[model samples]
Target: MCGITGFVDFTPASEEREVLIDTMTATMHRRGPDDQRTWLDRHVALGVRRLSVVDLVGGVQPMVAQRPGEPPVTLAYTGEVFNCDELRAELRSHGHTFTTSSDTEVVLASYLQWGAACAERLLGMFAFAVWDGRTDEVHLIRDRFGIYPMYYTEVPGGFVFGSALMALLKHPAVEPVVDTEGLRAIVDFVKAPENGIFAGVKEVRGGTIVRFGRNGLSVTTYWAPPARPHEDDLDTTVGTVRELLEDSVRRQLHSDVPLGVFLSGGLDSSALLALAARHNGGETLRTYSIDFAGHDKNFTPDEVRSTPDYPFVARMVEHLGTDHTRVVVSPEELMDPEVRREVLLARDIPTSLGDLDTSYLLLARRFRQDCTVALGGEGADELFGGYHWFLEDRFVDAQALPWLEFGRQMAGKNGLRNTGLINQDLVESLGSDEAERDLYATEVAKIERLPGESDVDRKIRTVTYLNLTGYLRIILDRKDRIGMAVSLEGRVPFLDHRLVEYVYNVPWAMKSFDGREKSLLRAAVRDLLPPSVLYRKKAGYPPIDDPGYDRALRAMVTELLADGSAPIQPFLDLGTAKSYLADPTSAASREKVNRFSLEMVLYLNEWLATYDARLAI
Candidate 1:
C-alpha cells in the first residue's frame, strides 16, 4: 500500500513542483512511513509514500517500466490488486518480462500492453495515477467498488490528485475550502453523493477514470457491476459464493508483514475470521475487537447474556487460538476532542456524527498496535440480500418499487427537521429531486420495462441496485477512510466481485430463506461458524451508544454560530441553530439533530471551521 500525489499542468516550475509533491506525500506519513519517491518533470510531477506490504524489499515507487528502448510509464499507486498472479500470467503470454513479483509490476506490465485501458482489467482495491512520459499524458483510475479513495482538485492552470485530501491541501494552489453543496448532500441524508467534502475538490467516482493529455481532460467509465441474468441454480450459487470468498481471502492474505482481521462479532467479519482461521492452520491469527466501556446497553436488544455474536467472537478467537485483543474505549474517549480531531485530520474531510464512525475509530486505533494490514467483513450486506429495512419494509412490499412509502417517509421525516447548520442546505437538497430521480432513471435504463412485470420486482431490483450504487458506496468508502486513517490496510473478502456476482443472481428467497436475510450465506459454510453465531440476527458493526453524539456535535455548531470565520453562519440564524439541536424530536424545533440529520450539520461545521471554508460560490 502507498500514498500517491502529483500535478498535471500546462507547464511546471521546479520550486512549485517540489513544494506540491512534498506537501501531498507528507500528509500520508502514517500510510507509508517506510519509503518515499518522486518523478519530477516540466509538465508532470508524481510523488509516492509507500508501506511495504507485498514487495517488502522490492516494491518501490514511482515505479516505471521500459522495454529495452521504449519511453517509460511511471506509476504511483495505493491499494492491492488481488489478482496479480492472473494478470502476470496473462501479461507473460503477451510478451512481458517481470522484474518483481509485486502487483505494481503487474500494473506496469498491463500498461505496457493495454496502455491506459489497463485499469479496466484490474481486480482489486486501488486508485492510481500513471504518468506516461512517452505520451506526455496522465491516467488516473479508481477501482470498481471504490475500495481505495482518490480525491482531486482542478485549478485555473492544472489538476492536482492525491490519496488524501490533506495532501492536496498542502499545495497552496489547491484550496481546502469545504463544499456547501456537499454539506447539503449530507443534510439531505443523501450523504456520500457524487460530491466530496472540499468545494473545488471531487472524487473519481468508482468504476471510472480520467485521462489527462494534451487534448485536455476526459473522464469515462471503465467498469460497472453487471445488471444481468443468473445462469446458475440455488445450490450452485451458494457453492460459488463460498468458493469465491475463499479465493478473495487467499489473495488478500498475501502480505510481507503479519496480518489479522477485525472481528466485530458481525456476519461479515466473522465469516472472514472463520476462513482466515482455516487458512492459518491453528496458528494464532491476531484479532482485534472494539468494545464500549460504559455503553454495554447498545446490545440490550439481544440480551447482553445472549447476544450470539459477542460470545461467538470469544468462541472463534478461542477456536483459532488467536492473540486476540479486545480494546475497550469509553464514551468519554469517543467524544474526546483530541481523539476526534486526530481522526478528522486523518479523514481529510469530516465524517458523519455518532457511533458508526467512532466505533471504527475505536477499532482502528486499537489496530494500530497489532497489525498494519487487517481483513474485516464488509460489503456482504450490500452484495447479498441483507439489511432489515430492505427485507421487511416496503422496499420489497411495494414490489421492488423505487421510493415506496418507506423512502417517502425517510424524506418526510428528514424534511420535518428544524435544520440548524444546514437548514438552507437541507432545503436545497430536497428542492433538487435529481439524486432520487437519477436512481429511478438508472433502473429504467438497466432493467426490462415489459408491460406485465410487477412493480414490486422492479422496485426490488431498483432499490437494491440503486443502493448497490449509492448506500453501499457510503459504507464501503467509510470503511476505507476509517481504516486507512490509522494507516491500516483493510481488506474486504465479501467485496470480491466473484462472490458478489454469485449472490446477485441468487433469488432473495434463497439468501433469506423463509423471510430471512443472508440465509444462503449462513448455509454455505455452516461448519465454519458456530450455530449460535450462524443464526444470530445481524447487528452489524457495534455502534456507540452516545445517542447524544449530536449534542456534542451541537457544541461544535454553537461554536461555529459564534465564530464568524465559519462560512455558513451568515446563512443561519442563532435561533434556528439552537432549535434544531435543542429539540429535534419535535417538528417545531430547528436543527433536528437525530443520528443522520445531526451528522450533516456536524460534518459541515467541522469542515468549514477546520478548513476556514467559505459557502458562497
Candidate 2:
C-alpha cells in the first residue's frame, strides 16, 4: 500500500545518509505520492513514500520510537496486514498505546511484542523493514506469497535494498549484475525460482523473513502454504473455502480511499465482485473491466471480439445494480510506440510481453482515476484447476509441458535465434539439483493418484506442482508488479492460503471433476454468479488481435537489427533476427520455441543498459 526504503550503515556521514534516503524514497514517488518521510539513527536511515490507503489523514511513516538519547527504532513498510484489528486488541490489552488507527502502528507494535517472529503471526501481502535503534540491525519481510517484491544487495557491488529493483538501482552505489541463473530461468519462463531478475539484486523470496544483524544477513522461511495435504469431504471443504475467501476479500477491502473490483466476466473476478456486491446491499459498488476490440469471438456464440465479457459483466452488475465501468483498449492503442515507451518506464524494466504488459498498467491507470485499490481474480487458475494444463491428461500424464508444447512446436518451424544470453544446451546438460528434483517428484507422486486418468494425466499432474510452484508464481508476480507500478493496489482474493491448502489435495477429480474445469470452484460460488458467467469458459485476461501491432513489433525488431546499435544484437544472429522479425508471425508461431521477443529482448537489453548490467555469467 506504500513504498519502503532504508539503509543499515552504522556509521555513514550525515550528508550521504540524507541523500541516500532521499534518492531511495524518490524512486518510488509513484507508489506513495501523497506523503513521504525519512529519519536517521546513529547507524541507520529509513525512508518511505506514502499512498495513504489505510490512514489517509494520519499514519505518517519513518515513524520513530527513540527514547530521548537512545537510538530509536524506525519502521517503513509496503503492504496491508489484514489482521490489524485483532492484533491491535491484543496489543492494547498488553498495555501498548496507539497514536493512530492505522495498520502501520500495528506492524511496529507487533514487531515490538513478538520481535522478528511477528511476521509469522501476521497474515497479509506485505514487505517491510524495521531498524533496531539499539542493535543497529535491520529486519525485513516479504509476504508468504511474494505478493510484494523487495530486492537487496551489499555495497561495492552490493549492500543496497529496495521494494523495487529500480529503486535499488537509484542508490549510486548499487551495481546491476546479470543473474545468469535468473536469465536462464526466464529464457524458458521458469516461473517458480524464488530469486529475481537482476543478478546482484537478490529478491527476498516469498514466505521469508530476513535479518541484517551484526552476524551479517540471514534468512528463514516464516511460512509456506500448506501444500495439498490430506483433506476432508467436498461439502466440508467447499463450506470452509467459501468462508475463508469471504473473510480474505472482506479484510482486503480495508482502505480509507476509494476502492473497486476488476471484474472479468469469468469465474474468479466475477465471483469476487458478486460477493462484494452482495455485501454492499443497496450501496453502489463501482466495478471496472477490460476487453479486447477485434479478437475472434471467444466463449460467446457471437463472432464478437470482447463479446462474452460484456454480457456476463453486465449481468453481474445489473444483478447487484453496482456502478460498473468498462475500459476497452484497442489492439492499436497498446501497440502504439508511445504506450510501449510509457509501459517500459512504468515497469522500470524492458518487458516485451504484449498481453501481460497491457492489463496491469492500463487497468491501474484507468482504475486509479476513480479508486486507489482494486480486487483481481489472479491465483484462481493455479488453485482451482482452471487452466487446461490442470486437466488430468494435461497435468498428470506423460507431460511434456502441455501448456508449453505450443511454444516448443513454434520453435521447431520458426527457427529460434540464439540469444547468447546463455548456452541453453550446456545449461540443460548441467541438469537440475538432485534435491530439487526429488521435491518435484514427491509432489507429482500425489497427483498420480487422482481418480480420473489419461496418458498425459500423469505428466499433467507433475506440471500441477510445477504450475503451483513455477508458472503460476511468475504470472502472479507480473499481476502484482504491473498494478503496483501505477500506484493502484491490486489484491487477489483466490490466493487465500487456507483455500490453496485445501484445494491442492482435494483430488483432481474434485477440482476438474464432472468434466468441467474448476468444477469445485463453480460449485462453491454457484449462487453468487449468474449461470452464464458461472459456466463461462476462461479466456485468460484480455487478449490482443491487431496484425498491425505484431507488424509494428516485428518492424521494431528488424529496425533494431538494421541499426546494429541495439544492445541485444550481439546476443542474437543477424540472420535469425531478420527471419524472426520479417516473418511477422514469429511471436505467434509455436516453432519460435524458447525464442525471445522485441519486448522480452528489449526489456532485457534495457535492463542491462539501464543498470549497466554485466552479462558475464
Candidates in order, TM-scores: namely 0.88, 0.87
lDDT of 1 by residue, 1-617 (tens): 78888888875465667776877788888778888888876687899988888978778899877657766778898889988988999989998888887889888888879987888788788889988878888888888778787888777677788888888887777775545455445444443434666677777877788877777778888765555556677778778878888888877888878788888676677788888877775677889887766555554443112352456678777766778888777667777776776667766666554556777777887887778898887778776666644676555554323322344444322232424345464366454355545545554475433344345444556556666666677677777777767778888778776676556655555666656667877877777887667777777565555555545655766676677766565556466667765666676552233454455555656666787665543
Off by over 4 Å in 1: 12-14, 177-180, 189-194, 297-309, 396-421, 424-435, 439-457, 546-568, 571-573, 576-591, 595-603
Candidate 2 displacement at residue 390 in angstroms: 1.7
Model 2 lDDT per residue over 497-559, tens place: 666666666666566666887788888888887788888877665445445555665666666
- Candidate 2 regions off by >4 Å? 11-14, 67-70, 156-158, 227-231, 296-308, 397-468, 581-590, 593-596
Whole-model lDDT, model 1: 0.70
When summed lDDT is taken over every stretch of 10 residues in candidate 2, the lowest stretch is 412-421
lDDT of model 1 at position 562: 70
- The global C-alpha lDDT for each of the candidates, from Candidate 1 onward, is 0.70, 0.68
Q: TM-score of model 1 relative to the true fold?
A: 0.88
Q: Which TM-score value belongs to model 2?
A: 0.87
